[model samples]
Target: MLIIPAENAVNWKRPPWVTLGLIMTCLLVFLFYQGGDSRLLDRAVEQYLDDGLLELEAPVYEDYLSREIRLQGRSDRVYDLQAFQQAREGGEPFWLAVSLLSDPEFYQYMTDNRDLLLAPAQRADWLARRVPIQEELIGRLSAFRFGLVPARLDVYTLVTYQFLHGGWGHIIGNLLFLFLLGYTVEKALGPGRFLLAYLVCGVLSGLVYTGFSLGSQVPLVGASGSISGLMGMYVAIYGLRKIRFFYFIGFYFNYFRAPALALLPVWLGKEIYDYWFAGATGIAYMAHAGGLLAGAGLVWLLGKSWFQVRESFFEPDESALDDRFTTGYAQAMGSLERMEFELARHQFEALRQHYPGRLIVLEHLYQLARLRPDLPRFRELARELMAEAANHHQPERMVAVWQEYLAEGESFTPLEAEDHNRVLFASLRHNDLKAAEKAFERLRQLGNDVLTSEACRLLASEFDKRQMSGRARYYQQLMQA
Candidate 1:
């Protein structure tokens, strides 16, 4: 199931810096830090094997796993290490060696029983060997050091882990949701409170995951937990207000408007369901649920205090604030899409009446008018669009429109002398000799008085430039006549 809010396609207000910063930070971490973690971790593991440090820690890790650490069937993941017990004693497994180092509890046991586990010289060697392995695990690579591990349960890892990711797919999916939900939440809460709330939600989310899998060695990474918190805040901030949402379930998708607060239960239920059914899918559903609840709770608390909900956040942006023009233009475009050219023309005509300066409406009107050149609109629209294009020094488009009009119309529009002159000038300026010839021929048929001196001179000069001396002399004679 996928659900997204159908808002903030473009942010009308101040930029959401906190959200953008989080996204950039996550991207940078993946690119610069986690991008090369694999080779470093691999070399560290190989070095651990070569140094015979596995011989020192593997036995202790097995003994640590043997105790009744956790009885819960689903929770006793420490038993997963039992298979590596033989490898621990007789053979060396790279994965088992990694797991041995990753286990904080076993490391604690190794620390507590350091004297007993190794003799003076042997202990010294083991201590020296542990440095490189630990540095790679918890220092160089963010996965073990910064990533939130249930066994380690470090305080700072909760925030740091959110910035780290597994791979390309992991960071991309998480950041996409962040952008969709983050901007609005940041706007409503403002940057300072939003940042605070975000970190708090992530910290709580980590705690929830840690509580569920206390003995697990796997380290959780990615901003998904915090991103889930943004989701909760999104629905709750709007409260009973209806908001548009786009939802998809497998092959089907649609958009609908519903009360914003109503979606909280739906999101929570989905997360909880996935947590139970798809727990082993490597997705942290519990943390997601926890983040959601935490975010909504934060909003609820903030609401009780001095946090004021900005009702104007939903108002149209500056670019789209002209509601009537925007709406009428939309209707015209919709009609055009449905093959209702007549309706589209009528709508565009109405728009032109209200907004005579809006050339786009006139442009649309001209395009629709072409369907029936027999009507006066074809000539009228062409004249208007061409004249406007000429005045704006946008002669190229007028040349094309002039050629198209010549092909369609039987005669030039009567009494639109200024428009025709503009069209002719634009055509010649655009170097379209074909359109100029057609235009001049039509004017000549209407008799000598209709042709302007400038038109004849331009035609003669253009024909001379093309080395068509016969046509040039003909226009020159017309100029004298």
Candidate 2:
């Protein structure tokens, strides 16, 4: 089964150059440096063979003399010494002969018998060993010498091992996860802390892996352990935010959603299960688990503020409409908060046509109108809100609608009149005199509507009780009108 968290869909900051740089460095090292080493070793072996300085005995001798190792793309195809000798003559390129040196038995025999084969000057070359010629030693040196070895811990291996991957698939898998999790993590922790956290997590994980697998000769390579640390940090940083996850098991495929931290236990549990039962698969599950713990522990130390900064991770949207809506709305709101009035106005206006029905959008437009009261958009937004509120039967919303509309020196429409009466009667029935009074004035604007007579009478009575005869007479005239 494969499961992954839903990637973030919005990026609020710059691209993660550090993560990209690390990936590129790993790619270059694998493709150019490590790959070229094998070819160089082949050349060195061929030169020694052509000069007749190299000799071998039966088994090892005939093996190097006749064995064929053909390079097919990135793979090696081996041919038995007898069959290869019959098929090809001695005139073949020296490098083909050199390829035979890769055989562990042949490489061992040559290393052990270097003294018999080498002249005094050649002895210096053998002793210097600048070029790795021993197949077993080369493999071991590539892994244990540079890669992290639990049995022989070296401080440099902690960081270097993260850059050395066993194969293309290994590096690609590590970088994919590093990109997904690392980008956001870098943003949360900031570039400096992000680097620190990454290395620290990797080192801590390596230490833990070494502690558990003590005395084991296997060398751990790849960024999986460090990326696992990022995963742990991801969980801690996101905390309670609902994160979507994608999963596949055999033919089954689906998605699930849960609070970000909820998956932490699931991930750790899988690693533990694999480490104990699937040891033969050759994965360093111990390192992965350790990295996870180290990452989470580091984030816990950083506290909640770091997590808050992580919300900017972007997961590009598949739907164009959603992208525009979210992007535009966010930009508009963000601009307003920053007091960037011109940009906020532009964003608000752009969204006005597309999101005219959204209450939140309309509310923001109304706010813009209050700030720039003369702007026609405010009145338009207020009108749209009034109609929407009426359709939804939201009396409280009409309060702003009326306020905005009236502040713009506009009279109530017939629908506005009906809504005013709804509020007026509801308020009077609920004994909210303040609200009833506010509604009474708007109700007065709807002359000859269904509730006008009762509203006028109510206003006149209230004025008379307050001993305000002049206002009472005005309402009496409105009643006659």
Best-matching candidate per TM-score: 1
Q: Given candidate 1, what's the lDDT at residue 142? A: 72
Encode model 1's per-residue lDDT on 1-481: one tens digit a residue: 8888775564555688998999999999899878788877787778878888876777666656655344434434444555677566666589787777655556666766889877888877877778656765545677877899897687899899889998899999999888888888888877887888788889988888888878766789988889888888888888898888999999999999999888889989999988876634678988999999988888888765644556656665446646888999999999999999889988998999877778898889888888888788788778778788877788888877777887786454452455566667677888877777767766666555755676899899989998999999988998898
lDDT, candidates in the order shown: 0.79, 0.70
**Candidate 1 RMSD to the correct structure:** 10.7
Per-candidate total of colliding backbone pairs: 0, 7
Candidate 2 per-residue lDDT, tens place, 148-207, comes to 877678899999888887777887888888887777787777787788788888899999
**Per-model TM values vs. the true structure:** 0.59, 0.50
Root mean square deviation (Cα) for candidate 2: 19.7
lDDT of 1 at 49: 83
Please report how far candidate 1 places residue 281 from its true position, in Å.
5.1
lDDT of 2 at 456: 78
Candidate 2 lDDT at 18 equals 78
Local error of candidate 1 at residue 300 (angstroms)? 2.4
